[model samples]
Target chain A: MVELLAQTGLNAVYAASYISLVAVGLVLIFGVMGVVNFAHGELFMAGAYAVVALYADMHVPFFVAVAIGMAFVGLLGLLMEWALFRPLKDNPLGGLVASIGFLMILQSLAVMGFGVRMEHIPPVTQEVVRFTDKVGLPVARLYVIVAAVVFLSALWYFLKRTRFGWALRASAQDPEAAALQGISITQTARIAMFIGAALAGVAGALTAPLVSVNPHMGHSVIVTAFIVIIVGGVGSLEGAILASIAYAFVHTFVTTFWDGVLADIVGLSLMLIVLIVKPTGLFGSADRA
Target chain B: MRNFLILLVGLAALIALPHGLSFSQQEILVFLVINVLLVTSYRLLTLTGEWSLGHVVIMGVGAYSSALYTKELGVYVPVSMLLGAVTAALLAVLLSFPLFRMKGFYFLIGSFAAGEIIRLIWKRFREPFGGVRGISGIDPMPDFSVGFYQFDFFEPVSYYYFAGAIVIACLWILWRIEKSPVGLTFHAVHWQDKLAQASGVNLRAYRTLAFAIASGFAGLAGALQGHYVGTVNPNSFDIEVMVFVLTWAIVGGTATFYGPILGCIVLTVLNEIVLREMGLEQARPLIYGAIMILSILFLPNGLESLVQKATRRKTTAKPEEKAAT
Candidate 1:
């Protein structure tokens, strides 16, 4: 029983890592651009497809594929900002609708490119690090966990120690005030979109081999990300991370104990309860709420 | 008199519309008529300044319940459909407790989560919802002759007319509601809720009322669809369907009652006729997505704005003639 609990804990940690990566990016884009970016999960799927095209199809190095995938999805994010979100800046609902359109396009493109069938990608490594005879963690999952921690730490550093970070944070707080301070709203928006999209991309690329990669995979992913972000607080980065961890633990435990469908129900119920109790979210800003 | 004449001509055209179509095209028309109701009902909710992602699920609730009512309780088909709408409305009122707490973006996500839970529940319970497979082989509306016309349930043309009548009736009610004082309060709640509240409007009650009414109509549409298709499944009312409703409303411009209906008809025609004829049916979603993006960018106010623009020009021209006369 102790071993089962420990194994579940480790699994939850892995789930939390990827979830936070996606949720953080969503929060950053929402915070900076003030758009929901509903195509976010598709951006994550785009990254996994990037890996499928590179590492799986072209035999590129795994790390090289991941890096390229991240950069590629970041550029897609930039395109979204320029083509969709930027024009719809004043209309948040329009931005969301446009993102949904983009999402459909991405899914259709994937279907056209890869067919509807799941692509089987060769594993990065087969070695498992055994904590005990009964408990084991795959090296591939460890790669995802490590990359999440490193990228998140690097993102934290960028958002805190740098001048660009200050500008990003400033604009997120108040775009007009930041604009008065000579911070380019457009520039900050582009930076935030790229970073936000790239995080989701990298997470998808990292977990591409661990999970089945398919055209419709983003649906569940986006739902989970939405639940996490809502629970964490819509626009709070720290809250997103904390909520992701909390949600991941609960979801993973429920899945382990009962079933996937029940876990989903529980997670959604939790989000609804949170919404009723605190519309601002656990760590959300009062002013924004 | 001119407006009444136009409406008569429009009704005549709608009645005559399906006769010119091929069998498959006629089938598409039936779905199109049903979708018209679905999108219009969605517009009703948007009037109160709230957009729900769960509208499709509420529609599904109607479909599932109506199907169950007929299958299990052995209720009459028409009565079962009404009960289904009532069920959906009641569900919306219940959901409002948790959902109404959030506004704007939060409401959007909250509604989505609530919808997903309902869908998941349908997926989880095999006894009632048939698990993931959903309740299939739903009871169809019984055939009956109406003196001048024999109302057959199997023919798409007959179904189209029957569904069209219900939809038209629903639209009439919806239009009346929109034009009434209650609707004005809804718009007031949307544009300036704080002021609406200051004016002694019970904002919560109004929002809930709009939501329930919208959901009731959506449920009716769903029940109509289930009876036509003879199946009710979880996937049938998923987010993708909701997205289609959203796009229709957005592309149609929800400012006018006719906007969303126009958007639905135009897009459905574009999708079914144009894409199907070109044998690019597989690329339909891609083209639809492109259209959605392009419309949002260029035609932000929707196809209705174009209609309004042309009408404005004619109406503006008419004033000069009136002065000359």
Candidate 2:
């Protein structure tokens, strides 16, 4: 039983890593643009597809394919800024509606290109690290965990230490004030979108081999990301990461003990309880809430 | 007298509409009528200036409730349908407790979380909800005869007439609510709740009232769908359906009562008849996505703006002529 619990804990850590990637991106976009990018999940799926095309089908190295996935999806983010977000800057609701439109387009394109069936990518490595006689961790999952840690640390450093980071944070806090300060709102928006989209894409690319990759995969991904971000607080990056970890542990344990649907119910209920008890979230800023 | 004549003519035309269409078109017409009710009720909720992401789930509540009532208790199908709407409304009132505490985007996400919980509940329990597969072989509306027309539940035309009557009546009540002083208070809340409160308005109660009424009518739409289709499932009330409803409300523009209805009717015809006939079944989502984007980009005010513009020009031109005289 101890072994089972430890194994589940390790599994949850891995789950939290990817979830944080997606949730953080969502939070960043919401903070900077004030629009919920419903297509954010599709951006993740786009990353996974990048892996399927380059690594699985074309024989590129896994890391290279993942890099391309992030960059490619980052570019898609720029396209969104240029086409949708920038135009609908004044109307957050309109931007949200446009994102929904983008989501459908991406999903349909995936269906047209890859067909509706799930894609199975070959494992990058067969090795598993065993902590005990019963407990094991796949090397691929470790890669995801490691990537999440490195990228998140890098993001933290950027947000804290860099001039652009200050500008980004300033803009997120108050766009009009940031504009008054001569920090280009347009430039900050572009940077936020690119970085946010890249995180989701990288997460998706890394996990593509480990999970069932399909056109409709983004639906559950977006739902989980929404849960994480909401529980973490809407616009707080640190809160998103923390909430992701907490949610991952509870959800993983629940799924292990009971069933998937029940786990989902529990996760949603936890969010509701948090909303009722503290509408701003556990670590959220009240001003933003 | 002229307005009453127009109403009579409109009702007659609507009643005769299915007769002109083919059998399959008749089926589409029934679904369209139900969608009209669905979108209009959604507009009712939005009148409080709250755009809920869970309206479709609330509608599903009605569907499941009505289905269970008729299936498990052997209640009269129509009466069960009414109970289903009540269940949805009561659920909305209850949900408003936690949901109304948050405003704007927080409210949107809160409502979404609340909805997912409800949907997950329906998925988890198989006894009543039938688990993931959902309840099938639900009781159909009993066949009957009106004095002038035979009402066979199996026929799409019959259900169209039945649902159309219900929908029209619901739409009338919705219209009345929108025109009433209570609706002005709702608009007040939407525009500026603080001011509305200063004027002695119970903001929370009014918001809940709007939500409950909207959910009730949405539930009625759901019950109509349930009896017509003879099945109910979690998949039927998924987020994708919610997206469609959202698109309809936006594309039609929610500024006017008839806006969403216009959007629903046009989109349904385009999606069901045109796209299906053109052998672009697989491309429906693609086309829908394109339309949504294009509409938001080019026609941000929605298709209703065009109608509003035309009417405004006529009224403006008439006033100028009268002023010259």
TM-score of chain A by itself in each prediction: 0.99, 0.98
lDDT of each: 0.94, 0.92
At residue A70, what lDDT does model 2 achieve? Answer: 93
C-alpha root-mean-square deviation, candidate 2: 2.5
Q: Per-residue alpha-carbon lDDT of model 2 for B1-325, expressed as tens digits?
A: 9999998998899888888899989998999999999999999999999999999999999999999999899999999999999999999999999999888887888898998888888888999899888999999999999888899989998899889889989999999999999999989999888999998999999999999999999999999999899889998998999999999999999988999999998899999999999999878999999999999999987898888777767877643232210
**How many clashes in each structure?**
0, 0
Q: In angstroms, how far off is B265's CA in candidate 2?
A: 0.9
State model 2's lDDT. 0.92
Stretches of candidate 2 off by over 4 Å are B318-325
Q: What TM-score quantifies how close candidate 1 is to the native fold?
A: 0.98
Clashing pairs in 1: none
List pairs with backbone clashes in candidate 2: none
